[model samples]
Target: MTIPAPTHQDMLAISERLGLGITEEQSKIYAEVVAKSITTYGPVAEISAEDTPLRPAGGSREHTVPTAEDNRHNAWFVRSSITEKSTGPLAGRTVVVKDSIPVAGLPMIAGSNLFEGYVPDFDAEVVRRVLEAGGTVSGKAHCEYLCFSGASHTNVTGPIRNPWGDGYSTGGSSSGSAALVALGEADMSLGADQAGSIRMPSSFCGIVGLKPTTGLVPYTGIPSLDAEFDHVGPMTADVADNALLLSVLAGPDGIDPRQHGVEPSDYQGALDQGVKGLRIGVLKEGFEVPGTQRAVAERVRAAADVLARLGATVHEVSVPQHRLGLDIWSTIGWTGMTETALRHNGIGIYRDDHYPVSLMEWAHRHGSAIDQAPPSVKLFFVISEYVTKHIGYAGYGRGVNAARVLRGKYDEILKDVDLLLMPTTPMTALPLPDPSSGIEDELRTSHPMAFNTAPFDITHHPALTLPCGPGDNDMPVGLMLVGRHYKEATVYRAAKAYEDTGEGAFRP
Candidate 1:
């Protein structure tokens, strides 16, 4: 069965709505991809083609791999159990779930083989929410094995390469979820973030990610981090869609033990209220890096003007101990890692029953080695408390305490600020990082991960990342909005305000 190609009209419609400047020729190709997906051969075509066929300027149909340039893809769309149809707010839209969440009947391997036959007893809390919103589950999004590595190249899934290019990495553990959304295979996706998993991939893939305030969404049937930072959040292409989904997903999930007494807010209403008169804080640490991407900075600066026009005030602010966050997060972050790793029978395999390899062994051998350390990436804490810990991966009492102090500083800073704004990545996406360059690719690729998103995880605050503009190379860059503890509405209002102003792109 041949998948139908997106009609020329379909291309025009999608292109207009998404604002992606696609050529008529590219549109035809995209339609072809869609047409082919509904038939029985759809699954076979997805993995068997190795790549799609491409025609040159002269129309010679040469073989072309399905890369990010496709803007649409079905090949290699990793996933979990799917619903042929959608049910709520995101109805008709395709979505992918990260591996950590339970999807009945699929291999809910959590990126490791240890639990291959372990059918989830039930749908995850977020899974229930997505289906209720009229959204269809496309597949379980591929992820770093066990959601352990920041880079997406786990042995089980190979590397979830950036759709932009084959050799480059899509920053992860949430890597596959981000890739699917970026590739336009799905409307949006879900991922769990304990540290920078959600934020980094969002930033790296040139999309948007929202790590809701702790307990905003129920976490039943999903894995947990430190009991401090595990959050299941939305990762999407548009800021508006993210706001839309939050409305559906945010609510009391009696199942998440962490939500002991927390109640979620009305996120949709908050978006309409917008950011006028809000105080958007500039986290001082975000721009402190050398070689920070100027394009990203310019867009954020322009965003401030839009906010000002929308009636919000922009001010530069810094927490007292931004430097110490590295220490605290490392300690706290890794302690959670070791403990989480200990939960698995295959600290190294995607399916423990089907595959017997240990995960850490694989990661240690293949994960981004710690050779390319950026001046700002701190690993002293991640190593000591998490990675190598043998005590069931429990090792962060000290770092967790230090993180508390850092949180206190952020709390004081937020006392007067409605939301915080920062450059999502100090630099835009670079070429595939070379770890042999003497630093961990993880460190270099994610210098801003700790400073931008990690602190919120520590403070129990909600944060969102938006694509502001292209950096020097025209690769996407992002801006961040962080709210005070559980004040996601405020953050939503502020970002929506900036988006409403329409002054979002870089002028140059």
Candidate 2:
């Protein structure tokens, strides 16, 4: 395809919009120069627009949108059987990916109608790794709209129901992934997290979720909210499966800029190692967050006691800066999401990454429809846009600086303690909001649940959420274990030790 050069009239209109104040004669001269300069774009445009054929290692692209009868929880967006290898660590394992990630021929809707029929021509790095490791790709699971909410009701298909109780929230934006794994629909899942998306849902649904250290897992081929905070990791029914999946998914692919010297480790090897002799710190500020239920906090404290009984030295530790995590994450996340994702069509500039050009084009075409998004998505857009226009980049800059201080604070505490323990969420699963609810009701249910988990995301620490016991109404309570950067082995070891007690299982 030939590149179309801008006409002199087009240049004049562009100049006016940019407030360039150029004369008509200058526009004509500039248009001629631009035409010559853009002639070099012809080959680049031609290559980019050309169709790139896909060669999936094991899975078939044939799929179907599951019917209501088959999707009682509204968990699956599309169902298919995709497997490449027959023998490996993940052999015969069913793995469902969150809808936010690309899976070759399946629609990557990201829980929004803006990308209704858009399908990727290639697999995300994680998906490719899953198939290569002999894991069967079951299908794509639905999530919160554009992954903006911490509650589950915002997905376009429907509210993802919790498997444990009726009409309860499953958490977001990895709502479906958690539900499916809990329901035995899949053995494991890959979930993305910006503001505790993976851990929140897993906590609510009583599954194991790990948010590996920032940059430990390559985020290539997945759309991001903010590159710095973006993470994709494993969700499973038990700690061992989570560790197994992490073993396959972690490591750099040399494409994503987020991976900073990341090296995959023997995650499975660390699962059998008990918490004996480890100094586990119970973070005081984690249980002190507002909206934390008394029962939930007590449940986590009991889990900490179990660790102490198992030969680990457990004691309360406080990092006061933990309270400010959400505010700092909000400032950086909102500003980065608006400028990088919404403005740049999910592929921000100035990075060496495998740009999904087709996805970018689709986003650019449907960008205007964002106004019709769900309440949570709309709220983020409004707040982010306001921050960009009125507060400018200075706000985001300060957030980045504050994040450094917060990280240092955690690091200082981590120097004394081998791992930090806390409640993954302040409370159990919230009830699903009614459809007739107004914007305030919708927004209320969606936000404020990430107070405990969001801090680790910014600090680049590894955090794992495992069910501690039943809480109010017999709802599952999750105890989180946080480890130093790139020390997922330690996090998994503690979580596995807790899981071994058979106490995480709720008999309700």
- Which residue runs does candidate 2 get wrong by more than 4 Å? 1-3, 46-59
Q: Residue-wise lDDT of candidate 1 within 296-402, one digit each (tens)?
A: 78767777667777778888897757656655676676555554454332222222111112223333443343233232223533464445546533446666677
- Provide the TM-score for each candidate, comma-separated: 0.72, 0.96
Give the poorly placed runs of model 1, Cα more than 4 Å off. 1-81, 84-87, 112-121, 343-382, 385-395, 434-448, 505-508
Per-residue lDDT of candidate 2, residues 262-322 (tens digit): 8878888998889888999999999989999999998999898888888899999999989
Q: Compare the candidates by lDDT and give the number of the best one.
A: 2
Candidate 2 Cα lDDT to native: 0.88
lDDT of 2 at 412: 98
- Reference-based lDDT, each prediction: 0.65, 0.88
Prediction 1 TM-score vs. true: 0.72
State each model's C-alpha RMSD to the native.
18.6, 2.0
